[model samples]
Target: MAVAPTPPGRRERNKQAKLDRITAAASELFAEHGVDDVTTQQIADAADIGTGTLFLYARTKGELLLLVQNAHYASALERGRTAAAGTTGALDGLLALLSPVVECNRVQVDNGRTYLREMVFGDPTEPHHAEALSIVAQTERAIADLLSERTRLGGEEAAAMAGVVSAVMFLNLAPSATADASVPEILATMRAQLAAILPG
Candidate 1:
């Protein structure tokens, strides 16, 4: 007979509520104005929390963006995974697995690029930055699983290929030279690259 897990106490609950408010405020402000144009004070004000409280959650604007975008990226990855399950051909399945992420990143292009930048360059010791990196790892694992199943590749080989695929996806998402490209255009380029890489 094991005891049931304890529920969150009042203090923990209050902390969660504050974090939720901060995430919501940052998400809305970043979407509306892009991360470059938004300020931490604005986020704190929108969250109805003080500036000091906001700093407790995220030290920098980039970290704040990571905290907000990580949730969206995680959800997009799940949608892609679901879509990939019903997909048939290897290329089609790969595309299915990647499409939602592309859509998510491109929704607010500048914000999307900035999120990528932060994920790549922000302090790894930061919790939000670590979460962002974790999502990227999850995405790679999903891709590796699909590739191994469809292409008969060994685990190590599949994971290596998945890393390549992830790189291609990020490059297309954050390309400085093609910042204005549409989702379809980015997908088309990715498809061509994957076509060359995948077993025919």
Candidate 2:
């Protein structure tokens, strides 16, 4: 007889259901009308949660953006990791890994500006913010792993280099994220900036 998989506990099932409702509602509204045009009340109503409960999940619109975008960012990191894994060239691998991130910011555009800006000063303890940080850490880890595989650098050196590369990429992308720049141009600039710092 095939054993039935254990179901999630009640509390976990309820939590996941609520999270699904919130993310689905937020993603739909943000995609259809843009984040600037959406309201917390509308999101809460769409998710079938009280306004107060929505606040419990996300304290502000910016945090709500983080919460809504967390899943997308995580998926991007995974895609980037996959891109990195298929290459031997350090720079190409790194570029492949980060292009999706820049593209993500490009897709979000205006909302991305708020999310990126708020991220600088956002509370790490917040659930969405923590998830965002974890995604970034995963990107950094991918870079470090690539470096370790391709370079003779020590683990510490690879880790430090990975952090530097990630920071520079984000900085390079910040202004470009909101500008009229094309994706190819943004990627070109990221490659140029990265090339300048890579040990020759």
Candidate 3:
């Protein structure tokens, strides 16, 4: 027989509850009004927590955005991974891996772009930012795996090409130049770029 794990103490449970409230409040408000228009005070009020308490969880609005958007990005990546797994051709696999991500990013275009900006420029020491970086690494690893399977590339070659693919995806997803582009349009551009660079 095996022993069960200990349950969280009251303090730990309380902390998790507060974190959940904060995440939900931020998610709803950001989805409704976009991050730019939503204030921390509003989030705090919505969560029924004080502004000071909110800062205890996320130091800045950008970090809060990361905390919220990271979950969405993670879910989208899971969907993409599943889609890619069923895909056959190299380009198709890559597009399948990226399609949901592009759709997620375009849901509220500014919020998505801002999330990318924060992930790039925010404090790496922060937990939320670190988690965001980890997600990006996971994405690259997934792409590299797909490349190894579908192409002549493997090891470092696959990894490097995966990084390039990631860059192409990010550029199309976040750039001011593509801000007005639809999800399908952004994906079309990515498909073209991948077709040119990836081995047939």
Candidate 4:
């Protein structure tokens, strides 16, 4: 049976309102002026919150970005899920699942290096960082499920493949100083790597 969601209390509602305002303000500022140029003070001012309160919500600028990106990443994951549902091929489905996330990350192109580093090694105690880690684990599980159901792979092998694919996805997300690589190139490389383990 389905359970209903709990109603937010006065305090929880107020906190959500504040978070919504902050996320909207940060998104607008980051859009108008790139993430690197926008300051936390400006974001606070735009959100009509005090600088100290901003710190309570997000300790650093990168964390602020993570806060702003929370909804966008969730939306991307939904889109990936929809795309994956329409595919039968294993590699193709996994790529479809990750494509939306990659595109979303591209929007923060200039902040890739810092964002990627913080996302992996940032303070786990922070709410937004914890959400990011949860999302990563969720994505990996989704991939493993696809492999197990659609391909001729055992449970353990499917999970191992998910880990390898996760590694490739992270490496691709990492900032590169060289010329840009398109999405096709990135997926082609991922497919080749996965082919080694997937049975024919």
Candidate 3 per-residue lDDT over residues 1-200, each given as its tens digit = 99999999999999999999999999999999999999999999999999999999999999999999998899999999999989898999999998998999999999999999999899999999999999999999999999999999968999999999999999888789999999889999999999999986
Candidate 1, poorest ten consecutive residues by summed lDDT: 171-180
Q: Where's the lowest-lDDT run of ten residues in candidate 3?
A: 170-179
Candidate numbers sorted by TM-score from highest down: 3, 1, 2, 4
How high is the CA lDDT of each candidate model? 0.93, 0.82, 0.95, 0.81
Instruction: Give the per-residue Cα lDDT of candidate 3 at 103.
Output: 93
User: Can you write out model 4's per-residue Cα lDDT over 1-200, one digit (the tens) per residue?
Assistant: 99999998999998889888999999988867878899999999999999998888899988998877767778888899899999878878888998887777767565544566778889999998998888878888888998898898889999888888888877876757411766666667766776666666
Q: Give one digit per residue, the lDDT tens place, for model 2 in 71-176.
A: 7778888888787777767788888988888788778677766677767779888888888888878888888888888777679999999999988877766774
Model 1: residues with Cα > 4 Å off, grouped in runs: none
Instruction: Select the stronger candidate by TM-score from 3 and 4.
Output: 3
Clashing pairs in 3: none
Total residue pair clashes for candidate 2:
0
In model 2, state the lDDT of residue 139: 80
- lDDT over C-alpha atoms for residue 88 of model 4: 78
Residue 184, candidate 2: C-alpha displacement in angstroms = 1.1
The candidate that wins on TM-score is 3
